[model samples]
Target: MDPTNGDEKKKRFQEAFERGRDGHVGSYNVWLENHGFDPSRVDRDKVTEFFRENPTKSVNQDDVTDIAEYAGFVTTRQDLHHIPVIGPSGIGKTQLLHTVIGLLSEVDDDIDTKLLEANRLGKKTEDGFLLDEYSRQIAELTTPIVCIDDCGLDKRIRTSLRELRDAVDAGLFVTTWTPERWGVNQDQVRDVFSPAKEVHLRSFTQSETKGTLRVIYDYISQDNFALPSKTEERIHELSDGIPRLIHLLALESLREAYHKELVPGHISATDAAADRLNLSNASARVQDLSEARLTVLKQILQLPDERGVQPGTLVDELHRDKSTISYHLRELNEIGFVERDRKGRRAFYRVTETIEPLVQRRISQEAEYNA
Candidate 1:
């Protein structure tokens, strides 16, 4: 071959580098946009101002560290696939995953990524087309990193989730679900996502809750606003270490203040608590609660908090088949109307504290109407 012209050769190399780098960054930006981050909407000035005015408070270090570790593996295109991040609902599973994916996209534009929510998976009647579409889309992407949030929430999608095995083998999967869906043991968890690494997310500590509230207040407030100590403490108490509840409480409290036309000041903890209870009642009402299930819920609520009702007691009281009682209890637990606890080897189920007040209120109203 003839010797290359120096200027032309340098120009060709530069062009190739630019194309590669551009392709990488372009892919990442697309991922971020698809996941709802659309960087163009980001207000860099506001972010910079917030950082300057309020020093960053450390919270969710474990969550950040774990997600970053897995994200690093995914970005590097490693074989460490099937990451199941387990936590209760509203414990920041989706938020943590989004942040990790956002950071990964920023750093590696070439990586393929997709997010699927379990509840969004259509009903069994509609799953055929959905799965076909999922297969088609996944086929087009190369080594797609798929994060399926709330994996165990719906029964309709369990079969579809099983179909993800192919993707798990060929690419990577990061899923989040509650521990109640499956036990914490590796074998038990493997039923949901086999041969997987588990990242157990802890609920927010009281300090983390305060830090998070402050962070939220800073982000939404236009001025130097301070959350009252009592308001913060009440939020911490009623929120029960769940970040989603914390967010809901904060927003509802603000709305309460707004409705009262009060100057932007302290968010009333009482108002937040009432809104949360109302929300719980509304949610409980909307769910398809069969008479059997409702009766089961009522009984669970009557049981003392420390001593949750057992399946045998439910069977005795309802005169229902053991399997039927178990099914109803499982449904209630899944909807969060009930919580399951373990003492020794036996599992006990009880109505969740959040729903207790609503249940009691309904009972009182019914009694009054009867009288």
Candidate 2:
């Protein structure tokens, strides 16, 4: 995005916040009561976080450890009063807080716990529903264990919410949302969460991405469904260890490959899951390949499957330099236009099954255009 566009957007949010802060947005004055926001220090993203939708997926491996630790912290030290869990969006912060609520109940069966997303609490703000009712619910909690998901989204009422948590002596578990992978969760954490032992979550690691996919794979295995062999590596590469991207790409790829439609009422299954988005991009990109690389791909498409062609074979068949052949082969494999098979220290290449027809179509078009 253009820097000026972002600056303008930020300016709008700051102006809106000022209206709320100065009591000009009279009905919404509850947000500034004890929320501790300084007009001089307003964070555009944190203060106006309702712009994003939370991405929820299966529990990742790191999240399991986080859940255990957080549940442990709350159960053993009830004196801390409030523990804010903060991280960039799609890092599973909301999922972690929700799990912690469940774990807290298991840790002590008698413990009462409730999970309320921040949006639900302040959803009626535009309808003139004073959030004081939600505040009252929090204030009178018989079960002092509370989980507030994505607290950044409704920060307008943060001061009132904090007071409610304190009034009930609640063991508040919260996650404040921030963006992901844009300069590494770039946001002003302090602008939203005060540093009272706030837990900062990290992005997913490659291993964690693979582990999360494996959990999904276990379910597909019973139906004999399988994905491409290198999917795990490719997904990890594409996601760069961001949990939301990892799951989105993996599930979409798997569903497209399996030719499956979502069952009724399963809202999370994307309607476009069967779209060959990556493959379509690869086709367009393949058309733009250098003459040398296109020749290499043409040969790979001709190579027989299972026993594919080696780089040395391409070098001899196409009369290309060995290093040039190797470079193009690596590029094709990375682009998902071709697959590499490893056998006892030897590597062979062929057009990927799903991409073979697309590659052939591009090659045919090139031949016709040249003719």
Candidate 3:
């Protein structure tokens, strides 16, 4: 249909919606009802006011701007582009993407934004009509932005990075995934997207952690919660620059302060919360070894015979620089994932039993599935 006819239909729908006087009657309304939210109790005006008050919605504007620029550069679209932001969970990836889309939509009335979780797409096992229709709508719409949340969580659909590369080639398709699982097939990923730009996001710095904590406290308390310089330093040290950990520590400290009716100044708290947060975040970083380290692990696990090759012999077989191999070996040894045996003056390395299965599985997956 022509633009005029489409506009007329939208106008008619609005008129009918207003005249009903009963309430909004549509799929969105139905969704609210199913989720146990009473449509009548939801005041549209209040929702608008809430969103206006929390414009950034827990996301930093600088990160959003960076992603927008990167997306534009890759998509070659002057106005908009789909960029995939990869990071660990609880690092505010989704928040950043949503903030950017909201900002872009505000500037251009013609742009439409749609958010879909990868697991909910028609790519799942128990498929539904809702997902099918949603995908169809996405393909049909001329929207400038489409954000797919948790793209790597759907193990079935994210089998290869090509699935996402194809989407990028077709149009803007922004997605987010954890570093460990961004692309399904790791070896084939580089082959599919030659020189694809990788934007690595590190945990916050000490200053950034302190700043984030201050912001959270200010937002929640509506008052400046003053702390001694040493207290802030301790918090930063304990949180280790992870944003989620910083937020948790700040909130926990605040809660303790509130419970005790402690004054805003000189608040003393235990570091237990920070320790727990660090333990939780550490697992996300476990699989993030460097390529050189992974190559060494693969070689040790893939050797045909039980008699593992010596470090020098393995270096010669792989035709890698001696220093590079040594660097990887040292890293693996430090991590306690590999052990070295001394044969005279020569060092022979073998995989520790704990990580041996993991290395073997990774190698087999890369050879069988990635190939």
Off by over 4 Å in 3: 1-62, 70-82, 122-131, 159-170, 183-196, 258-267, 270-272, 275-371
- The residue-by-residue lDDT of candidate 2 on 118-230, one tens digit each, is 65565566544445565566566553666666554553534545545555643544545432211122234334334345555665677677776665444333432333436
Question: Where's the lowest-lDDT run of ten residues in candidate 3?
Answer: 276-285
Candidates sorted by lDDT, best first: 1, 3, 2
Can you write out model 3's per-residue Cα lDDT over 31-135, one digit (the tens) per residue?
Answer: 434433444434434333333345564434566667566545534544334355766555656666667677766756566567777765534344543456565
Q: Pick the winner on TM-score between candidates 2 and 3.
A: 3
Candidate 2, lDDT over the whole model:
0.53
**Model 1 misses residue 339 by how many Å?**
15
Please list the C-alpha lDDT of all candidates, in the order they appear.
0.61, 0.53, 0.55
Candidate 1 lDDT, 49-71, residue by residue in tens:
44334332335757656656665
What pairs collide in candidate 1?
24-109
Q: Which should have the higher lDDT, number 2 or number 3?
A: 3
- Shift in Å, residue 164, candidate 2: 2.5
TM, every model:
0.56, 0.47, 0.53
Model 1 / residue 83 / CA error / Å: 1.5
